[model samples]
Target: MTNGTRTALATALLLAVTAIPTSAVAAPEAAHIEGRLPSGATYLMDVPADWNGTVLLFSHGYRPMGAPNPAQNAPDDTTKALLLDRGYALIGSSYASSGWAVTDAVPDQLATLSVFKDRFGTARRTIAWGQSYGGLVTTAIAERAARRIDGSLAMCGLVHGGVANWNNTLDPVFAVRTLLAPDTDVPLTGFEDQAEATAAAGTLTAAADAAQKTTTGRARLALAAALHNIPVWNDPSQTRPAATDWEAQQANQFPALRGLIQLPAFSWRQEAETRAGGNMSWNTGVDYARLLGQSSVRKEVTELYKKAGLSLGKDLATLNKAPRISADASAMAWMSRTSAFTGKLTKPQLDIHTTGDALVPVQTESALKRAVTAAGSAPMLRQAYTDNAGHCTFSPAEQLSALHTLEDRLTTGRWTGTDPDSLNSRAAKADPTTPARYVPYRPAPYPRPYDLAHPADGR
Candidate 1:
């Protein structure tokens, strides 16, 4: 939170210690190394007694700007034990600072591998793996690191690209500001500081809550969620709501929806704009009618608006008539150069997603698939899905099975046991103690994906 603490994150000067238990899983016989890079990028490493010769460079997802940055070797404490006990060398960094800091995180994470090699010797293979924003970082590193990294595993990731992810979010936030709470001075693009973003999120959440009680409001909320492809069943531990259970579903997902969409992607805008040096997101040329028509949930929005006795067209007209937001050309170029993905992958990569990820919708997986196809690197990619809700809510078995799938391709020069049935079986057969829950489901492409359609056009 403090500049002093944030700066400490980039200082990587770790020391080795015996592995200690952090979760239900027993600690493995491994050396736990802790250090910081010259840039204050703190790191953590785990080398099992019988090292597997391969290292997993674990890149973590976005952390709020003011949150503490700690070295992460796994997605969770339980995962730390799993990766280490499985005989895989693991290393990660706190990444200088947090909050949409992919630019810093990518290089800091890549630099971590060098520190690992210098201290513990070079690994025979290095696989990059991450979740959420880290997933996007893994994809970027995979594209750029190329021959240096052997494989990648992205779970519930934002591989849809950097600015592409945040910029598209503006669609939903713009809808909220224009349709639901026009009077609220919530800055959809720029933020003076973290508090401004935080305060705006509170205002948007209140608006979402009030709007959910009425037909037109519900219709508008549906439109906003559709534009962002945000799922309705958002509770972390709940199953997908039945179709007739619309009220419950809306209530369940609204908080996450506002946090994810209406409030600058959980107020990461302050930090994001800082990195981009200005407003890097825009919706000036976005045609609401076209976007609504192209949306994955368009049918649902149509039904909602029809049931509300309102014309969806009129609302879209309102959006089109409202003054559109634009971006600074310099900032636009910065985000695209740094945040957008070129899809130039040189190694095999696997993406794991849950069908109902509320934050980074499963639709992003499809967008990334398109990007890979455009780059003619489709041969190097594989995707797996689970019928679950919540972001990065993967079971240990599912997680380990995904890792095995990536490692499988790296070793055999071919993919095996990656289909739904096979992957479910693999997950079921994964760790005896850590049970598995893998369901088969295919995700539809994101409907409001301007980033995927026009990589250079600011969304």
Candidate 2:
């Protein structure tokens, strides 16, 4: 698997990876197809030698707004090989555009499926799956494209609508601005273009970095992270933070907090605003004190503030008294109409998220669960978690295991062996290259844009 490796077909990738089988199982004759849609979107399709008639559509996460969209045919090279070896067809698109793409992805993916059908004929079943922002796309298809897709698997999803997700991300940035750098002049919202966004990100990121060096600054950062339910342990290479690792955890948490400033606050939100035709997130009338109290790390923040002899209450009170960010009414309307999941799931869905994911927090699962419940599709949805840090950092085994779980639910018309122990066993049996990391965990409720017309509006 050298980076320069290629096939007889144009730019066809032959994955040289450890987790994938060295050779196709039973020497199945698979058809590897690649092409471009009329809309200028590239796509890849894999029809297994066995032809099980079940196709898996993979949607990718956010790419920088201006980057070229790379056509994605599967979740990853390893997972693609595993699915192909097991006889499942795979198809996906690069999407017509990138960055905060939920607006375009839903239809683009449906179009990809349509193109797939035109080329390959009808399928017996179709499964939609994706990671990170694509996870949001997967959920959108699950709810809106029910007649076409049979089941969905969302890994490390931002299933909470664009409004709630971005607004929550703004929590820490807002805190750093209002409490620590009120006079820093960083534009918190309403970016006119990419340059303004990048500049603001630099300003906020520097403020966060400087403030994290002091106790009170750490407390305020913690408070904002809590509001967004940002996890403490963010590096995938590191183990979970122990109770005694409070400072170590905060140290680890700082970069993730900075990431919120740079990526979500600066880049993602502006892209979302482009989709919304205005601003769709607002923190008007938000009660910061109540949000802090409900956070999972309330104890830790309290400890940090106590050690610094700073009054957590005073900061909370300060936030409450300060002017809040508000969404443009038209933009709010656009986002509500175009960027949310109303649950209303017509097919089964299995969502897997990491416990300590910094980009798309584990609490996202909680947010989606409530949305599905409100849609009366609660019984149609199931969730799984892994004790991992980082965003969409699941091992290959974790990915296939979640797909298997969804397939099982679809087959049985009921959930089977879904507990952490059961899922771990299944994952071990499925993929020998890696061990299962499934764990039973429930994340805290979402903490921003507190309420909405859609259940995904708030966790």
Query: TM-score of every model?
Result: 0.88, 0.91
**Clash count (model 2, backbone only):** 0
Off by over 4 Å in 2: 1-29, 449-459
**Candidate 1 positional error at 143, Å:** 1.0
**Residue 443 error, candidate 2, Å:** 1.3
TM-score (C-alpha, index-matched) for candidate 2:
0.91
Query: lDDT tens string, model 1, 140-226?
Result: 889888766999999999888766676677778789889999887677767777777788877877888889889889888988887
Native RMSD of candidate 2 (Å): 10.6
Top TM-score prediction, candidate number: 2
Worst 10 residues of 1 by lDDT: 12-21
